[model samples]
Target: MTLHATAVPFKDGASTLFPGGLPARGGVGLKPEHFREIIESKPDIGFFEVHAENYMVDGGPFHHYLGRIRADYPLSIHGVGLSIGGESALDRQHLDRLAALIARYRPQSFSEHLAWSSHGDLFLNDLLPAPYNARTLDLVCGHIDQTQEHLRCRMLLENPATYVEFAASTMAETDFMAEVLRRTGCGLLLDVNNVYVSCINRGRDPNAWLDACFASIPLSSIAEIHLAGFAQDYDSSGASLLIDSHGSPVARAVWELYRRAIGRTGPLATLLERDNDIPPFQALLAEVSMAEKIMYADAPRALSGEVCA
Candidate 1:
């Protein structure tokens, strides 16, 4: 499945070679509950994203609905099981399936997390963080390189929403991500909620983290932005802890951060991610609308008449 690197143009910053790429507007995760409604109602969404693992099967109802819905809207495929930072080499069979799925859909975007979810033969269900160091950096870059070569498309790497940091880490998270992007020539799926949750849980200012990212990561490398809601909790030490639980609506604080992010990225494609406590399609669309409004407000000149009402 190894393909030439130049088979798919590498996307960097605002310049893109992929035609009909994901629009710089708001979208939501396409859920089964909302599939029929989406197909029938035809909401004014900019695009739809689906977890790649869900649609890996050869043929089924998931494919049936997705095939139908995808006809009218742009699609982004998000992967949760690539384990790009895992100690073990990637699963070849899984990667092959992923390549097949992407070929079938020809999605405008494809992305995976910087975190790993597997070790050896056992696959974990959670997205775990990796140490920010030279060794881990090289491992991630190699994995991403393999992925791009196999799929023949550039993929976006998402920042993790972590509850803890590795004590042996030698580099900051932003620097690690920047270096990975530089080495692999992949785009970034800047999950703002992950930034807010990880920073709040680690006793750091989220704004400061965003500032570091803006200063380090190239704005063009950021191909997409994700906005989600988090669950709040308290640590054993009585400090506030935030969980990257994609339930509920986008929090006020996260929205504010997203507004700031749009200011820097200049109206990049945004997704409102909700995995648990699924709500009606209208509710998710409302959140999408709110994101569109924020994007337009932050970059009116760039987004004028581009954002759907």
Candidate 2:
């Protein structure tokens, strides 16, 4: 299942594929708590992203508000259950449902993680890591090809935040992701918090990791950015560990890294994700405002309609 044959070239950048896509600004994850407020107030934001799994059912309050909200803002559907990096063949039934959801909403962008979450029939509710080797690379690329072929739309592959490393892996995570994008022609959803979390856990400098990523991954392939909060913990070795908790406000260090990322990638459709310890809608909007300020402060050209090519 080599998908390179049907891979669409991201010649300029991922944004070029959809002219009327998400604006180059900040967005917040659409939670049920904020749905009513969003519809009533119509907050001035760049876009709204929702997890596809949450809206997989028919005729409910979720769809009721989402239908109304989608009309007013750009929507990005992020899938958490695709298991694109899994060893088994993709679940076609699940894919069909996802496709239906996309068709219903007609979101501006669709994305999934570069990690697997299921094995056999037992579905793990976590995004587990995969070994970065030749076999895993081929499997991931094939899955992305299948997803794109079925959805008839290019999807963004988000980098994962891992607390452990596979000793069997033969390539760096950044290199592996770069190869995946090259082989599949998919866009990237660069999660700055993930970078910081993974690096801090693995005893690497997040800034240097970002530098390495920029050198390998093209700026154009990066269609969106994700900022989230992480919980702090200590491993058995008494070393600091960062968890991708998404339970608090974006940290100061993560914000600094995001600034550096935007300076390089220019203004992208950035997302502020807070899945746990859910805060008030106004609090999330404040974080969104912070992200907007970083984008404009670091890349003023974004206001002039200049983005990465």
Candidate 3:
């Protein structure tokens, strides 16, 4: 079982990496561009999330600065190369590297994407989508089970922002995900922007999709939330195709979706992801402030009239 302080508690005995689990407040992606500023300023954000693949190294400035920040704030290690939706088995070597990093950093939370990025040893450098059918469902569950058991910790699976859908799909994304969580006991990293992007691309109603997904899954199954900006574009047919490119400010629609998501799930670890066209550190922090404000609102006030500290 996990322990809780004023913040959520870390896994039973992971007192060293994080004294407590990441606070259910706004956090920013730990970018190399902001490392110095972050370490020097020690901003008031709840935590920081790092791409686990980038830190599978021996030692360097990355580790140096991350070590310093880890001492002062909560950390979340998010992985992009797990390919949990692939047909092939999980990569043993890659899993070992991830295990080593978790043992070293002891991040408060760990997560990966639901999409696959590899096939038969040829690793694709992108997060590709998969069909939502019985076969793929079983494959994903097995992978999640293997990952959680091998790491000896629970992991959160993120939803993918797909540009297309498979006619062969037999299940809705929400149902497939809920079943996986039930079977493997893993958690969810709900990405509100992805939901909006996918819904827009597929000509589906974003609000309806959100309602379906949230209704299907247990609220407690959500371990974290992600907000990011997407690049707007058009496909061959001139239909709007929003790419999940984390290069701009969070869209107004996504922010509204996030408001509703938090209303349903309550406070959870929220992250702002900006992977390209990186900007000044404070700019991202400003966005973090917006998210923190939303979280603070609708949040129950204390008996003395002060908000829960």
**Winning candidate number (lDDT):** 2
Candidate 1 regions exceeding 4 Å error are 1-18, 304-309
Worst 10 residues of 2 by lDDT: 10-19
Clashes of each: 1, 0, 3
Q: Per-candidate TM vs. native?
A: 0.93, 0.93, 0.92
The sequence of per-residue lDDT tens digits that candidate 3 reaches over residues 46-139 is: 9999999999888999999899988888899999999999988899999999888888888988899999999998989799999999999999
lDDT of 1 by residue, 72-130 (tens): 88999999999999999999999999888877887899899999999998989899998
Deviation (Å) of 38 in candidate 3: 0.9
Candidate 3 or 1, higher lDDT:
1
Q: How close is each model in CA RMSD to the real structure?
A: 4.7, 3.6, 4.3
lDDT of 2 by residue, 114-206 (tens): 999988998998999999999999999999989987877788999999999988999998889888988888988999999999999999999
**What is each predicted model's overall lDDT from 0 to 1?**
0.87, 0.88, 0.86
